[model samples]
Target chain A: MSKQHESVNIIEVKDVAFSFGAEKVLHDISFDIHRGDYLGIIGPNGSGKTTLLKIMLGLLRPESGTIKLFGKDLKNFREWSKIGYVPQKATNFDAHFPATVHEVVLMGRYGSRGLLHRITGHDHNLVRKSLEQVGMQEYQHRLIGDLSGGQQQRVFIARALAGQPEVIFLDEPTTGIDEKTQGEFYALLKKLNEDLNLTLVLVSHDIAMVTKEVMHIACIDRTLVCHMSPEEYLKESHSEKIFGHDVKVMTHHRHKK
Target chain B: MNFLSLFQYGFIVRGLEAGMIVAIIAPLIGIFLVLRRYSLIADTLAHVSLAGIAIGLLLGVNPALSALGTTVIASLGMERLRTSKRVYGESALALFLSGSLALAIVLLSLAKGFNTNLFNYLFGSIVTVTSADVRIIAGLGVVVIVLLVAFFKELVYVTFDEDAAKVSGIPTRLINTLLIVFAAVTVSLSIPIVGVLLIAALIVIPVVTALQLRKSFLATIVYAEFFSLFSVIAGIFASFYLNLSTGGTIVLIMLAIFGAVMASRKG
Candidate 1:
């Protein structure tokens, strides 16, 4: 949780704006991320954390401004090998999809394999290696739907890792997971950061957990209010500024528990 | 005996061949239909296409061609309805089904001659099918099936999660429209071989049977194909040997297979 890596400038967002019809979601938001930056994006519900991540990944078109990854526009750098995404706890998946964990993970390789290319031995090895990395090698043949929420989250991370992307975007990757699993998940991500130097940008409402996990934090609420280290963002004064007056009562200094 | 002679004489070869191809493709499309929760879309399109064919009779054009055109138009409407956010896909399909059937009834009443041609369209026959029909069925079957296999991964992804598919950079919207288009056209053309009432059975039965035994996506497709082939062949020969209706017999065979699979799965 230290501000260690500072020179890479891997992602650059300039004056980004987004809206659904007439109502705006992100307003003139801007930010920059460098290599090995595990940036945590946090905000209250409906704060456009997911939308901002989607725009960064080129999944959603911004109403204005530009987003660049590794000096190239995001839309232009969609070599699946260069990017990874773990959508917010894939709860929307149909339980009867009939695909095994191995098969689901293999789909991550499809973008890198290009159109009409079959899953090759290299892709299979990478998928297996990703599963092993997530400690899910044992569940490789099991139906994805049969897994627990935490196990399923690991599977999704494995899927993202299978792409071998430099930067991975995880949309609230720890939702509905137990506290023990959440701690292990954070440790796993930290290991990825230290060992492989994988860049991570995650969205979540778990401020305390994210402060313990991510190094840099973008505390968002309909705008790119400020970018700071998690500790600074967690300061008593900053928390009030970010969450407004009502947040003071949330941490009431009640003498009795 | 008279109907048996049609198959025994080989003069009815084209219709029999056409029936064989449609029987296979209907179930292939049906697998995705059921997965996407759009299984009823097929039934609706089949009924709508019937009205289109009836209109064709009133205009003296080929009923098959009109059915294809009208189904395409109806499919476009279904897509628009699905996109409207307020109207669910199932309700849209039902609306089109009811609307088309009513139009067809009125149109059929105005046609010059109705009984035999309409009966053949409704119940299907080996006697009235032409070489052109067989050729169309074969070409469309090959193209649709091949396209499906070629885009197998994308199809599977979309069938399970449309939003995920779109976010992953797959052309989910285009693929969605294309699927309904493919379904509508295939249903329109296939109904001439399988009656509209039983087309749903042909589409649903094979996949249901395959799903009982197969867990993987690819295996399900292959097993569905196998199930379809079995039902069609058994239905054809049974209908030929016993002098029964080909369309009805084929659907009954599929339904029997479905029932057996359900019973086995339950037990």
Candidate 2:
């Protein structure tokens, strides 16, 4: 909201398009993420939300257009440690993976240290601090697989926080958590955004919750239908357009009661 | 027989030395492979190593060296084929495994016949280990262990989540290449001690046993090496007293240990 931070573009996507064989996933999508922006990308299933996030993260190459991260082209961007990512809640991780919470979080430091470098005391302190920030410090010694889904998500968020990244991208983080846990999870994200000044880009299908939490929303269905403030999106009725159906946008206050 | 008497013979000493070295490195390699769900690749590479051994013997070179060379190529091929997105990783392994087995059989037949000495390489003979074999095992063990320690962090990160590792700037492709190459070296080097048919057991069983205990990653690795060393040492003793196949005895010991671990967990 500050005038000085208005011009800072943490992420800029220009006319990006992607397709898997004949099925076009994303087409000519454009968006901008300012510094300290809490961006929520929402869409229906198979609407290319995850694909756009992957393109921005450089996991998937777009068929066309350019992405700039922190004012540097994504291809040339070398400061990856400054950007953190928590994938869709460890669905790919084995439940019996033999790693403790502390060990899992320590992996975040691997990017900064490169190969062959030993983790210093400063790094260990940061890991502890990150766990503390996420209020999971006491469970640091527990096995990652032993934790519940919500706890695992917190540990993952702590893992991302350990790197001290300026921005973080999360993909469907609250997939399996209960409603109470989801509220707690959103509150944690809100705190991270407001207190630490961490820019966030989260992709989710929970339109009502996401619109309430994020300052800006990007509705995508193959291409970006609109990128506007949550209030503006609700007023303009972008949900029906994005979902390709008569969707209702219930305000967050309805859910609070 | 006294333990000291067992060590008096040069062949027994060499066998023990090489077996111990193989025991250490195989589990170290196995833990990563199992964690990454690439355990089948171990069996595939082991089978491929046989073709290398056969080719080496046909050309009057050291079979172990030839096996190493062949496995390196085959392992790299497996990695490439899996990444091509044309086939599933398991399917790729099956293709390579069958291809290598066919090549081994052809090479064996072309080399006049499956002589008893060459047969020893396939089934493993503890009494036939040379000083050269001992040196090679020691050298390879040191290199693998050193490289593993140096890249431990990166490998762990990559193994847990490859996409996250790549986005984190860990050079996942290079790390994956390193893992497969190390796996090749492990399988090839293990051929002299456990033979082609049983090398996968030496690399995989101990890690599987460790995973059942719910230990942390480093603890899992340490326990795997311990179980591996136990199986090799005990199997050597069993082979010495019972006059059984060294590699077969070792694998059986591992299987027995696995059964016991699983049973205990059930209990």
As for candidate 1, its interface RMSD to one decimal place is 2.4
Candidate 1, residues B1-267, lDDT tens digits: the string is 565565566635776687778877877788898888787888898888889888778888877778889988889888988888668766777789899888888888888546887777777666666776677778877888888777767777678655555546677777888888889878877876676666777787788788776477777778888889888877777777788887898888887888888888788
* Candidate 2 wrong stretches, greater than 4 Å: A1-7, A246-257
lDDT of model 1, residue B13: 72
Q: Tell how far residue B137 is off in model 2, in angstroms.
A: 1.0
Scored by TM-score, the top model is 2
Compared with the true structure, what per-residue lDDT tens digits does model 2 show for residues A206-250?
Answer: 888898899899988898988888887777675455565635532
For every prediction, compared with the true complex, DockQ reads: 0.38, 0.76
Model 1 C-alpha RMSD to native: 4.1
Name the regions of candidate 1 deviating beyond 4 angstroms. A1-6, A74-80, A237-239, A245-257, B1-7, B11-16, B84-91, B212-214, B240-245
| Candidate 2's TM-score | 0.96
Evaluated with DockQ, which candidate comes out highest? Answer: 2
Error of 2 at B105 (Å): 0.7
Instruction: Summarize candidate 2's per-residue lDDT along B157-188 as a digit string, tens digits.
Output: 99998877887889999899999999999998
Model 2 clashing residue pairs (backbone): none
